[model samples]
Target: MVDIRPDWQLLIDGGKKDSDGDGQRAVVNPATGEEVATVQEGTAADVDHAVEAARNAFEEWSDTSSEERARRLYAIADRIDDHFDELAEIATLENGKPKNQSGNDVFTAVETFRYYAGATDKFYGDVVENSKDELKLKVFEPYGVVGVVIPWNWPPMHTADFISVALATGNTVVLKPAPQTPMSSIRMVELMLDVLPDGAVNVVPGGVEPGVALTNHEDVDMVAFTGHDVTGEAVMKSAAENINPVMLELGGKNAAIVFDDADLEKAVSGAILNAFYNSGQSCASIERLLLHEDIFDDFLAAFLPAIEELNVGEGMDPNSQVGPIIDEAQYDKIQSAIDGAVDGGAEIAAKAESPTDEHLAGGHWVPPTVLTNVDPSMPIMNEEVFGPVLSVTSFRNDDDAVEIANDVEYGLTGGIWTSNLERAHRVAARLETGMVGVNRPSFVSLGLPFGGYKRSGIGRKRDLTETMREYVRVKSIQIDHTDARYSLDLDLAEQRTY
Candidate 1:
């Protein structure tokens, strides 16, 4: 068993470590079905201390040039890269995801640092000419303390992405990883201290209470959250009590439309990968598949067989194409969603059966599942199942397909599979999502602005220059140069006023 007692302190500014009493929480290895270690839960007092540390550090850290800040961020990313193998193992053990996926997560984290490192000096404000000889300039300034609540589904990738960008933008951060998957993040923060000030990146591990404290803290200038809509609503409500600014990426029930002229081979492969990637835990995963009636039967014939061939097991297994669900609660939730969809008149195309004892020796495993004959109005089509479950429905034409895709409240992402260039652009225009993937599975990039239109999320993430602006406030300055002796309008304005 991993030692737990040594990790109960908060890393404050200047590398000062302070204990948060003996409040302990166990870290379970979802793959092994056993507790690996225990971490001290941060109390309200601990949060206050961390926030104060950031508040104190901001005075000097904010004054540091963006180049210097970018240098430190690069150092942090390099440190993470040097230990990618070991960190990938930790991610697999705690997150129950494939090792290759873990490595990909690390790559994304590193790329986020690289992307924002170059974007620091690029965040320039504007100059407006309201009148001659009067200059109006806008300057960007970082918010003092930023609170980030990362979800468990993709801990390292999500937490580190937020950490690198927030710090590079000159804002100090306080992060609380989801209780289920917090170890990798704890280690990331521990190593980050070698390059960054301890208080500049504070990590307070605990259950919902610490998250609540951080969200409601009056000193916290801004909040960034990635999680379910219900919890996001609570965070938003609490932050609203203080009228604090927030950036949130909530849940999504994304859609994928398949046209008749599409390549069946490519569509099936992309759809299966889209629906089953990360066991469908991703918010951008395409959960709804809308196929044109002309080729609906042909598409199902190709897709159903692919689902039956998926290899599901532990993350460490080289042969495993799909890994286990994150934790027990998620396992149960996935099961419930599958059963509900079947009960709602959707036919089960292929159900990944419960594995044998050998397969269940470690990890919480679930196989890829697909449903057909699903109606547009079914709960499975509307709700965010967030599992390896895809609901398929048939549409008469491109317009009907787009209508079915836009019927949901979520506007996060949608996939369109069509060979016709005109129809691809035409149908893409009708869908009401923030991001669209035409003839592709997924399209999430570190440089793209990622967010939703409606209930999916609020605000944007990871835009080239806009991300830094999210953590900053604009200060407008106006200078009156009309007093120059040679100014053409200086005395004329004064005489007109007289």
Candidate 2:
């Protein structure tokens, strides 16, 4: 059993501090609607301190050898693995995700760090041959400091995603986690400091004040954010004032296309998982389901039963397959979306009954919901529900499927389920999403770049090589081997002759 703390302090420069006397906010567990912990609510002053510390540490940290950086990253990964259960418990308690899912989040984080650790020595710049007398080289260098803002849904995983790559590329970071779920991130940064130098990683837990300060700070060279689209746009706007580069992984209204030739069982199972995982809080969650006309009925026959069978209760329970929403605001948003869909003439194809357990009565729970006859213009179809609500529509052909899938403003992730190899490639080529799973519901690995295309987001993450490129600036150097006076004289003579 892990010890639940009543209060946690902010981490800055390898030590804990109060939030500049700004006081604290209660961190509630959605599973029980109880205050699991209280964390310092950092202010703009705290943000300034964190950024200054990171800026001060950047020089020495960036100057470290790549091999040494790799060793430290590996050490951090090992420590995460050593304390996996403890971290997972904290994650579940604060984020309201299942114990098993939290464990997987930590596991993915460890692997992500390890993956970037190996790339430390493999990342290289280019040396091109321009002329015999001169040599041209392109060298990569780290941006002095990075400001990272992570969402509450996937705190540890997203935290690791940005910090690991930023640190691996020799960029110090000042991270601001979502106010609702800050303890897990605080603890993760604390563990990271054991291997990293002071100020290499700092955490300022707050709502919007610290984020605004971090993005608009003159010393912060770049900003990486993962959250709602509106907040992401605000972050971009603030960073633009200082001409800082911003990497955003914003909201997604993803779709899944199922063809007649697809495996019914596989498609149904994958679709259910895609729609309901993390209680459907993922940015890449499949909120829209596009089914071919021929397979719509068959798909629903197998899909409804599975969605109905999903168990929803406390995340800590070993038997619970789905957990409560992150907070009351999110729960209300999801409920409103469902009500709006029903009022818009959409039919509820399948909806899981609320849990009967008396202990879970106060929790913010939304059963796995599936809607059919959903029009493309419905808000549930166009907007991001960010819940276990799936809005389904049918397509008569490939063209119709493509049109429906690309109808939304978001192009983050999509799924294509088909047995026809030619059809799969052709359809995938036409889909506007940044990432597509051909036969699988989700396809995310360490090496592949994960990001969105349209309004969903800007830039990518996950791939070590690509992530490093984003965190660094390039400089082109040319060495002149020929005598400058002789060259100038020759040029003048040639000009006179002309």
Candidate of highest lDDT: 2
TM-score of 2: 0.97
Where is model 1 more than 4 Å wrong at Cα? 1-9, 14-19, 130-132, 357-362, 484-498
Can you write out model 2's per-residue Cα lDDT over 287-398, one digit (the tens) per residue? Answer: 9999988878888888998888898877799888889999889999999999999998999999887777887777899989999978998899999999999998999999
The candidate scoring highest on TM-score is 2
Model 2 Cα RMSD, 1 decimal: 2.0
Candidate 2: C-alpha lDDT: 0.89
Clashes per candidate (backbone, < 3 Å): 1, 0
TM-score of 1: 0.93
**Per-model TM against the reference:** 0.93, 0.97
User: How much is the lDDT of residue 115 in candidate 1?
Assistant: 78
